[model samples]
Target: MGAETNGNLEFLSKIPEIKFTKLFINGEFVDSVSGKTFETIDPRTGEVIAGVAEGDKEDVDLAVKAARHAFDHGPWPRLPGTARRKILLKFADLIDEHAEELAALESIDAGKLFGWGKAVEIPGTAENVRYYAGAADKIHGETLKMSSAHQGYTLREPIGVVGHIIPWNFPSTMFLLKVSPALAAGCTMVVKPAEQTPLNALYFAHLAKLAGIPDGVLNVITGYGTTAGAAISSHMDIDKISFTGSTEVGRLILQAAATSNLKAVTLELGGKSPLIIFDDADVDQAAELALLGNLFNKGEICVAASRVFVQEGIYDQLVKKLAEKAKTWTVGDPFDPKVDKEQYDKVLSYIEHGKREGATLLTGGKPCGAKGYFIEPTVFTDVKDNMMIAKDEIFGPVMSLMKFKTVEEAIQRANATRYGLAAGVLTKDINVANTVSRSIRAGTIWINTYFAFDKDAPFGGYKMSGFGRDLGAQGLEQYLQVKSVVTPIYNSPWL
Candidate 1:
């Protein structure tokens, strides 16, 4: 529901409509080289929210040139660690100050609930900035033990100009994830956000300027992947490319990068994660978590537990209870304060596909309404591990519940898919938890709780889900290069 513009809430609700035309380049707003622009439509209302700059190869070259210049000869990379940290801290504070406006833009543009955008995504972005800001001052080199008559050490230095391409599902958060660490590591970057959700990113560039970030240190370009994205990936000036999107696109980026400088790449791609529920687990709690795991963010998340592997002993009971609970989840306008219409029609379409694909939908295989993208939260029972619904990464609010006889079968079925982003297990037995957790090949595993995260935890995947982490110290290391410094104490006799 849109907030009221009266009484105590007037100031909070009086967000002015933003009209963005030009992209942010070299610390200023400028149009594309071709003078091209595209309309960013709101998924909820199917209305053109704003016309964004349509950047192509030439624009990408300009942005990358600026960023490369900044990284090679500008003060951004040469700044002391404390100075960089101070600037990042100020950026985070500015984000906090404009939290409401950013959240509103994200909610309207991305079809996410305003409450979630305000309460979780915006604050999380600020925390990520602050986290990396603090980490900026702590990056250091190590002294090595030398066997020869030479002083040996190592340097962890910035990888130079980086190209960051973010996804649409979590625009603000992913922007911070890719940009914060790169900036903190002293690598100037040119960011290409998903065309579906480009507004928040442009707004972020505005905030960076407000925080006193230097020109060419951070830039935002808006355009399709074929043109703008290809140029950024294939640019010789870029030293590294950090992308968060589908696996298919990541492969293209890798190929393009290879064609040029073979830049270091960090990709956080797709997943068809699993949630296993054992016989001894709390059935009610497990069912609730199952629903939440698949329904959170309208199941638009990359690590959403699309497949649920339940033990045979309690499979039927859990399925029935989960179906009843799924019915209670309201689907309506995302702006509606009382409803959770986040995924709506997009989710419903997946539900229809499940039925048409002969997945034997046990419950919730229909649309909740004719208006909005509202799909009934659906679950399938007679699902096999090899089914399309189970194997594919359906980015919607649908879960395929399958049964397994033992832990070995569960693990076999869970790891059968190429994805290994995240998995959840529900069991009271510590040994069982430990065994199952170690056996499942996901990047992150939960014992009883599902969809949990920490800023310090390393998150990524094995297999086709893609690699490289997004948070923690390990995440920061992805943007850095390790250089070994060697100097001889005395001239070699051979020389």
Candidate 2:
């Protein structure tokens, strides 16, 4: 460990101080009620970055109480939409102003690349905040056309206290994705940032206060999922919950919500997405896209194209192109942003399983560096439909490449797995694109491209991948409740 992290030394110089480690409740940074703490490890050096407050059931309860009070009796809900919008705009401005610090913190905490965090993640988070802030004043309900002789309308009101359980990958992005819409909808929330990467969320809480958000409106509790997350899911005061993580955890949240006050739940769960490259597609471009789809975010993406199906004619050519394009992907941050040790071991284990299951390793099946949890970009060829690597959501930089003779076969194999989160179809023919994209059983399908996410476009998963959306006007729908109001006219039939 002594000399293995020399690459990180220069980058470490720019890392921001690890401040705001305590639980953020009622607009104040405070320790957990139980006074316990957990270590947040830096993935690059395998070193403890800082000790953060470990929120348990008691902490979650306090967060819930504060959020409930804010929603029920505070000014956030009663304030005009424009007023809320103004505050949120200021919040976005603050995020933009501190983009560098936030990016550095993400790098130190989550092993995320500083450049990408600075250029894309940080600014993109601010953009989403602004997007939702603009929509704060535009939430509208339709004037109902009643069948009877009466006047009727619908009011879209904020759903009470909400619980947002964000995943570690892309913490800031997911933060804005869930919190911004709820904030715009005038709903108070208790947030449980993933324990592995909780620093950014805590920093976000600090920024929220600086932007003049009312006390108790947005509270963040950093702790393990079994305790804090489970408490949030089952808390009676929390009217709704939005979670992004594994399907296994998602089911637990659903059960907790059902067993409690029957809180609304929105889950954006895991995926074993497929990228289909047809014979008619551009070989080089498709290969590059396949690399991008598999390795983007170090292959930690929930929507990663871990399964790649290539047509029979161009399979060999595209495979070579894919390996060639993979060369450019090697350049990035010093340590790839793996969440923690478990993930690193898990990725290595998946690679081992891929080899044992008869899938041929095309390239990169081992660890990258001596120290840090870095798995090399791995690709396996001749992957069968039934193999674990092909079916399971490995959540790593491992790709399973297979060959299909026809479009029907490709589509069949793409939708073979239990996941229906996302998929990519690469084809020059419009008819093929239309047919394949429509046939795949996924919530979002990209044609000739991958990861085309936007703030205006709603995103979610299908089947076991979970329900509800996280962006666009629909993203805010989960945070709001619709109530119908009707009044009979003087000449109504009832009168």
Candidate 3:
């Protein structure tokens, strides 16, 4: 197949050649125990970029051993909080130094927008590292005054080896989200990057070593989720598992952890989040936020506002502006080539589902170029609550618009879905914002903007979206085990 590079991709010449492509273990890059390898394709060009090691059960066991050793006896966990913080700061600086390479790797490996990869994902990842570095020494425990007979306190200790099963959509961001906090919490981890996008994780392993993290502190395994992921979830030696993926896979991981060591687990799963635009809001601003809410990252986001509710008073004007904005989007070649065929087909299928379910096609409904995986940015109007496109989590650039009469109706319709990951409300009325935000059952509620993520904000979902927060102080708790300590002020009679 012939691949078309977007606008000649002059920047591609600046990307350094990729070198490392193997399972990272014990501060070294090595092949799988079975001596097997698999091809990692560039989603943009749909061509083989490199042959990555195919890690299996044997590889997972070895990684777990490395992590277990690090947690139990290695220098990383034993290091002073200040020392750990210094090393993590160095790691973040190194990432900043190599931001271009990491961004290029992510763009090539995952079909992320080139500008977004270079300007947003890479810098944001480093920010996460730096933010958590500041928290390394701040993992505080409580000093309590109990009954006078005893002095009682608590300790927040590391939970030992952790398994991080990363997702493909936001590879670098997701990696940092799990790894940074775990590192800050003094936990060693075995990371299984998604097979579809393993390049950046391996690159990061090299950076971690350069930043002076000890051997076995971080191990990355690349392979099919069934073999390597299963081993990690069920590994008896691993103390906890942090996963970001679909609800189906999250359930399987929960079961595996339950049946094996009953290890601690935190999941960031699927979502069908909603965005509500009231009549009182600025129509133009609402249209812009609505577009960003649904189409950012090609709508592959877990918290994407795929279900949009516009107040009936301004529904027609908002839909018109949204459609016009959708048409203006440059819909080809995310990095240099287009999106991968798999995702392209998936988005197209959802567009077709919208048509079949009686949703009016607003502006776009077709693929872009003939050469690469490019789908036109799509919008739909007159969507009903029960439509498949309205309810299902279509992780693509397709927006479903529906009309609502009142704020109560919007809140009720938004909360009707099984998911509760995130929601956005656009309104000038402070009461409307407060009331609707309070009523909507979502982990995060955006008052006027959309997709505003910060290191200090805790992010997660209720209902089927998943449990456990991923950022902020709550995120660090995921890798920590709380223990109460009690000591007598004087010698007891029994003693």
Candidate 4:
């Protein structure tokens, strides 16, 4: 491999030893009930990294039983919030201590940039956990002024056993996004990571054990989404399910949860978000934001700003800069393959659609290198709002550029999609920023910045992007159920 690199991308070379591949249940790594195993492939080289245990309905049931017991009879749910906080802080420290190994595993397993994982994401994950750990000791419900002749106060209690179905795009990020908050709320869980990437989740379970998290408090199941994911969703014992994935699969989970014990559900689904660049914006900064917004993480993110609406005044200049950036955008994977071939093929098909649909190919509308699922960073101009390239959630490094005459028009065009996960606005006019940001139907609208996700701020989507928040105090609420108790005022209402 060469030492070539791109901005903020350090091409580190290291093959992490695959230590844990079995399903983690009841504080121990164990084989599946059926003794079935599936080969986990390294996307960089398309080679088998390890034969992970294939957890199915039986495995999920066992995990759920453990989680249920943990919640009902064990100490996790019954433990003081301060105690939970202490243990979770230890877990966060463990994560930080092993940052390098986890980053290497994540980069190889998910085809992510190694440097970003090590320097940015890994540390960010530990911080997120710490944030939640701090919040654990602060969970409390407020007193309610009742209308009746009674005094009332509420108790915010852990909902119960949770089923976390996380995606492959941001494996550890999504894991902590769900797990940290739930743990802070004193909830036990059964986790099913994306089959495409499950190594870190297992490692996390190991860390949990070392952190003094009790047996059956946190379990990780590794297998395909259909068998293991569905089992977790439909398990009668699970009190809630938090999922991050496609809207299509989110629908399935909703159905499964509804038909089971009617568990509470939180879904962070798909998006076809937009990034608007007005005429007054700096062309260079706008171009950088657009490229980074759509191309970061190989465009596998749900909130990728694939739709770029540039005001006609600076459209041409921004387009020129974007073209140059697209050309220089590094396309390489650690150890070997850098992207999932399944998504790689899908991204190529979208590129062809851009051509056939009459969108002008500005730069990078083709594959790169001789081997693996590597595609050039693609950008298209003269794109119509109704075109497939502009309308669909392609989930790739493909950007669709369109010209808009007015802020109203930009807002309307941006809100055209069924998805409303996130959007980006680039403008110097405060009025324009306020107007367009308020008018957009998306859950998050980034002004002058993109991908500004944080642990303190809540994150989720509107419309097809799904419901419920994943960060902040709001994130912890998703795993808690409120119970109100009232007492008649000194025998005034004895009748």
lDDT of each: 0.85, 0.90, 0.88, 0.89
Which candidate number maximizes lDDT? 2
User: Which runs of model 1 end up more than 4 angstroms from their true locations?
Assistant: 1-15, 337-350, 368-370, 491-495
Question: Global lDDT for candidate 3?
Answer: 0.88
Residue 462's lDDT within candidate 3 is 92
Better of 2 and 4 by lDDT: 2
The residue ranges of model 3 lying beyond 4 angstroms of the native Cα positions read 1-9, 335-339, 491-495
lDDT (C-alpha) at residue 200 in model 3: 92
- Per-residue CA lDDT of model 1 for 7-82, tens digit only, reads 3265336344885657888888999999989987666556677888999998888898889888888998888889
Colliding residue pairs in candidate 3? none
Best by TM-score: 2
Question: Against the correct fold, how does model 3 do in TM-score?
Answer: 0.96
Model 4's lDDT to the true fold? 0.89
- RMSD vs true structure, all candidates: 3.1, 2.2, 2.5, 2.6
lDDT of 2 by residue, 14-37 (tens): 788988999999999999998999
Worst 10 residues of 2 by lDDT: 330-339
Indicate the worst ten consecutive residues by lDDT in candidate 1: 337-346
Q: What C-alpha lDDT, on a 0 to 100 scale, does residue 485 get in candidate 4?
A: 89
Clash statistics: count for each candidate: 7, 0, 0, 2
Stretches > 4 Å off in candidate 4: 1-13, 335-338, 491-495
Q: What TM-score against the true fold does each predicted structure earn?
A: 0.94, 0.97, 0.96, 0.96
lDDT of 3 at 429: 95
